[model samples]
Target: MFAFIISRLLQALPVMLTVALLSFAMFAYVGDPVAIMLGQDYTIAQRDQLVADLGLDQPFFVQFMKFVVNAAQGEFGLSYRLSRPVAQLIVERAPATLELALCAAILALAVGVPMGVYTGLYRNSWLSRFFLTFSLIGVSLPTFLIGILLILTFSVWLGWLPSFGRGDTVNIGGWSTGLLTWSGLKALILPSITLGLFQLTLIMRLVRAEMMEVLRTDYIKFARARGLTNRAVHFGHALKNTLVPVITITGLQLGAIIAFAIVTETVFQWPGMGLLFIQSVAVADIPVMSAYLLLIALMFVTINLIVDLLYYAVDPRLRIGRGKGAH
Candidate 1:
């Protein structure tokens, strides 16, 4: 296990380097970042000063190396718009995004897995068909559209929830009492649901399919023949066997949650890295944007790595070669 992780770390170096190179080349080739920074008022001389000050006049290679090195040291340079340390800004805002993302993941698991279990257990029955149809609708809708619809229905029409933001501005972090807890949870519900819709749909389909297969296996029949209850035969034997694949789907979707976060953030006015990423692009805050990208990619790769390790632990047969299995 240790060797596997060390190998992954070594492989990650080149992947990350490629990401940096591509991001730098694309940003530099596509836009006049310095002029954007200068805005409309600056003359050619002023633009030159702005470019030089930001070290844009340096060779591209030198600039990229410098940026990469500084980013590794946790200095993501200064934000052009905020005039603050990019790392500091991200650190301050990270929790809000993390909280939102975690909530969405939980929501996906809670709703998706149970529905999937029901569908799988019932097979072609009305309950299964209803859940399958619901999952399809969830998957088909765009997240932004879903978010807006949620806002309209729950906030404007029903007047049950707030339209946007994390919660009350005054107690963004301080609210922990009974009433406030409910308020905070209420505010988060719609956004979390909006963020999780696609993932939930995907998980539902995966779980249902895997469980259907598991139920057909001889071991499940053996468990049933042993006079086990229907619930035990399904949830214990069948669902447990299905979990390895379910975990894989869940881990893969963890990466997707972050990817989808961009759209969801914009829709709900969530003060997450996704919004920061968008704002940075308009003016070309390279360091901030690159750092955000790198961090997200790391989250994705790291989750998959953890899943790989977990899979090995979950089923020892995974370690055996396919050639060995064929024999």
Candidate 2:
């Protein structure tokens, strides 16, 4: 397991470097960030001076090295637009995005696993038909469309929830267990549903297919024949084996959810890294944008590491497959 993890870490190093370098290059070349930041009135010399001050005049390698060294000291650089530390901006806003992503993930798991399990179990039954139709719509429809539809139905027409932001300013920092009560959960419903839609569909299908495949295996058949009840055959034996691949897919999906959170945060005006990232991009605030991307990359790396660690506990084959599975 240790060897496998070390290998995965080694593999990820180059990928992380490439993603960072490519993202930074795109930031540099896609637009005149200085011009975008400084606006039209700034003269050519002024822009040049600003570039030099920001080390834009330096070689690309030099700038990258500087960013790496400075970043090591916990300096993510200043946001040209916000005139604030990029790290601070992200830290301040991390909670909202984290809360939203977690809520969405929970909602997806709650709805998707059961939906898939029952659908696959029943096969051609009415419940199976219902899930099949629902999964099709959930999978086919884009996330933003789901968000809009929810807003129209629940907020606009039904007037059941507030359409924007986390909540009133009064509730911003206060933590009451009661907040998790009805009103708080209600506030979470729309955003959770909107963010969870695609994941739910994805998990439903994955779990269904996995469950069905597991049920057909010799062990499951034997379990059923050995006087094991249908419930035990399906839930215990089948679901256990299904978790291995499900773990891999679910972990990757979580990383994807973080990426997609940017979009959902934008659509709902949810206060999160996504909202901040969009604002930073629009202003060409390189530091904040870069930090946001970096943090996101770190999230993937960290989660993958955790997932890899989980393998040893789940199955010894994962630990034993060290070299034979090497790329």
Judged by lDDT against the true structure, how good is candidate 2?
0.80
Question: Which pairs of residues clash in candidate 2, taking residues 3 or more apart in a chain or in different chains?
Answer: none
> Per model, how many backbone clashes are there?
0, 0
Candidate of highest TM-score: 2
The runs of at least 3 residues in candidate 1 whose Cα sits more than 4 Å from the true structure, single-residue gaps closed, are 30-59, 169-180, 319-327
lDDT of 2 by residue, 194-290 (tens): 8888888889999999988988899988998899988788888888788777778788888888777877887788887889998988977887887
List lDDT for all candidates, in order. Answer: 0.81, 0.80
TM-score of each: 0.85, 0.86
Model 1: per-residue lDDT, tens digit, 1-327? Answer: 566689788888887888777766765776677766677787888888888887888998998898678767887666777888988888776766777788899989998998888888888899889888888889999889999999999999999997787774333563222124656667788889999988898889998999889998999999989999998998888888888988988998888887668888888787778888888888778767877877887787789888888887777687775326434
Runs with alpha carbons beyond 4 Å of true place in candidate 2: 30-53, 168-184, 322-327
65 Cα displacement, candidate 2 (Å): 1.1
User: Each model's RMSD to truth, in Å?
Assistant: 3.9, 3.4
Question: Candidate 1: what lDDT?
Answer: 0.81
